[model samples]
Target: MEELLEKLLQAVEFGKVDFKSPYPPQLKGENGAYELTIKALESGVGPQQILENALVPAMDRVGKKFSENKIFVPQMLMSAKAMGASMLQLKPFFTSGEIKTKGTFIIGTVKGDLHDIGKNLVAMMVEGAGWTVIDLGVDVPSARYIEAVNNNPGAIVALSALLTTTMVNMGEIVSDIKANLPTTKVFIGGAPVNNDYCQKIGADFYAPDPQGVVEHLSKLAS
Candidate 1:
C-alpha cells in the first residue's frame, strides 16, 4: 500500500495522467494517477488514506514549487490535471460519506474580469486539499456570489481579477457580501491584487498565487 501510494504521489506530482499521457517525457508509459489510484482502492487502501497521504502532499509540493517560481503555469496546470484524475476515482467515496471534506469553498472571477486561469487553479488546488469547491466561473457578479453563499452556507468566498478595472469591482462585491452575510469570509487574488488592495476592498485574505489560498484554507481547517 505504501509503494502504491508513493507511486500515485509521484505520478500526480510529475503530471502523469495515465499510461497514455506523455507530457512528462521521463514518466511516459508508467501507470499514472488515474490507474494507480484505482489500483490502490482495489487493493483495499482506504479513500481517506489516498487523499491525505498522496493527493494532499502531492499538491502541497506542487504548490510550494509554484510559489517558489520553480514551476510555471503549464507545469502547475498539468499537475492539477493529474490530481483531478485521481480525484475522479475517489469521488464515489466522497459522495458516500466515507471520505469527508474539510469545508466548502466558493470561488470565481469578478465581473468584467473574464479571466479564469488563476481562479481555476485556486479552485483545483483547494478541491485537491479536501474541500468542496463551488466554482462560479468567470465574469461573476455580486449576486452570483451572494446566491452561492446563500446556497452553501458557511462557505469561504474567493474572488480573482486580472485587470485593474475589473478588480475594482471586488470592493463592491465584498461590501455586498458582507452586508448580506457578515459572517462570510472573502478571499481575493490576481495580478493586480495585493495585500493593501485586499484590505482596502474589505476582503479577509489576498494570495498572490493559488498555493497561498490552499495554505490559508489549511490553516482555517486546522
Candidate 2:
C-alpha cells in the first residue's frame, strides 16, 4: 500500500497525467495519476488515505517547488493537471462524504476584471490542498461574493484582481463581505495589490503566490 501510494505521489509530483502522457520524459509509458488512483480504489485502499497520503502531499511538494522557483507556471500547471486527473477519480468519494475536505474556499476575480488565470491557479492549488473550492469566475461582483459566503458558512474567501482599475472593486467586495458576514476570512492577491493594499482594504490575509495561499490555508486547517 505504501509503495502504490508513493508511485501515485510521484506521478502527480512529476506531472504525469496518464500512461500516454509524455511531457515528463522519465515517466513515459508509466501508469500516471489517473490510472494509479483508480487502481488504488479497486484494490480497496480507502479514499481518505489516498487523499491525505498521496494527492495532498504531492501538491504540497509542487507548491514548495514553485515558491522556491525550482519550477515555474508551466510546470506548476502540469502538476496541477496531474492532480486534477486523480481528483476526477476521487471526486465521487468526496461527494458521497467518504472523503472529507479541510474546508470550503470561495474564490473569484473581482468585478470589472476579466482575468482568470491567477484566480484559476489559486483555485486548483487550494483544491489540491484538500479544500472544497467554490470558484465564482471572473468579473464577479460584491453581491455575488456575499451570496456565496452566505450559502457556505465558514468558507474562506479569496479575491483576485489583475488590473489596477479593477482593484478598487476588490476593496469594495471585501468590505461588502466583511460587513455582511463579519466572520468570513478574506484573502486578497494580484499583480497590482500588495500586503499594504490588503491591510488597507481590511482583508484578513494577502499571498503573493498560490503556494502562500495554500500554506496559510494549511495552517488554518491544522
Candidate 3:
C-alpha cells in the first residue's frame, strides 16, 4: 500500500497523467497518476490518505521546486494536469462527504487585468493544498468579489494582477471587500506586486509565488 502511494506521488510530481502520456520519456508507458490513484482506491486505500500522502505531497514538492527555479510554467502546468487527473478520481469522495476540504478560497484577477496564468497557478496550488477554490476569472470587479464573499462566508479572497497599470484595481477590490466583509482575509499577488504595495492597499497577505500562497492558506486552515 505504501509502495503504491509512493508511486502515485512520483507520477504526480513528475507530471505523469496516465500511461499514454509521453512527456517524461523515462516513465514511458508506465501507469501514471490516473491509473495508480484508481488502483489505490480499489485496493482499500482511503481517499484521505491518497490526498494527504500522494496528492498533497506531490504538489508541495512541485511548489517548492517551482520556487527554487527548478521547474518552469510548462512543467508546473503538466504537474497540475496530472494532479487534475488524480483529483477526478477523488472528486466522488468529496461530493459524497467522505472527504472534507479545509476551507473556501475565492480567487480572481482584479479588474482591468486579463492575465490568468498567474491566478490559475495560485488557484491550482491552493486547491492542491486541500481548499475549495472559487476562481472568478480575469477582469473581475470589486462588487463581484464582494458578492462571492457574501455567498461564501468566512472565505478567503486572493487577487491577482499581472500588469503595473492593472494592479491599481487590486487596491479598490481589496477596500471594497474589506468594507463589506471586514473579517475576510484578502491576499494579493502578481509580478508587479510586492509586500509594500500589499500593505499600502491594506491587504492581509502578499505572496511572491504560488508556494507562498499555499503556505498562507495552510496556516489559515490550521
State the lDDT of candidate 1 residue by residue for 1-222, as single tens digits: 999999999998889998899889999879999999999999999999999999889988888888898988788778888988999999999899999889999999999988898888889889878789999999999999999999999999999999989989999999999999999999999999899999998999999877889989999999
Model 3: per-residue Cα lDDT over 51-147, one tens digit each: 9999989989998998999998788778888988999999999999998888899999989889999889899888877788999999999999999
Roughly what TM-score does model 1 have, to 2 decimal places?
0.94
Which candidate ranks first by TM-score, i.e. highest?
2
Descending-TM-score candidate ranking: 2, 3, 1
Each candidate's lDDT (Cα)?
0.92, 0.92, 0.91
Candidate 3, which ten residues in sequence have the lowest lDDT sum?
72-81
lDDT string for model 2 (84-162, tens) is 8998999899889988999999999998999999889899899889899999999999999889988989999999999
Looking at model 1, which ten-residue stretch has the lowest summed lDDT? 71-80
TM-score of each: 0.94, 0.96, 0.95
The deviation in Å at residue 22 for candidate 1 is 1.6
TM-score of model number 3: 0.95
In model 2, the Cα lDDT at residue 97 comes to 95
Residue 112, model 3: Cα distance from true site in angstroms: 1.4
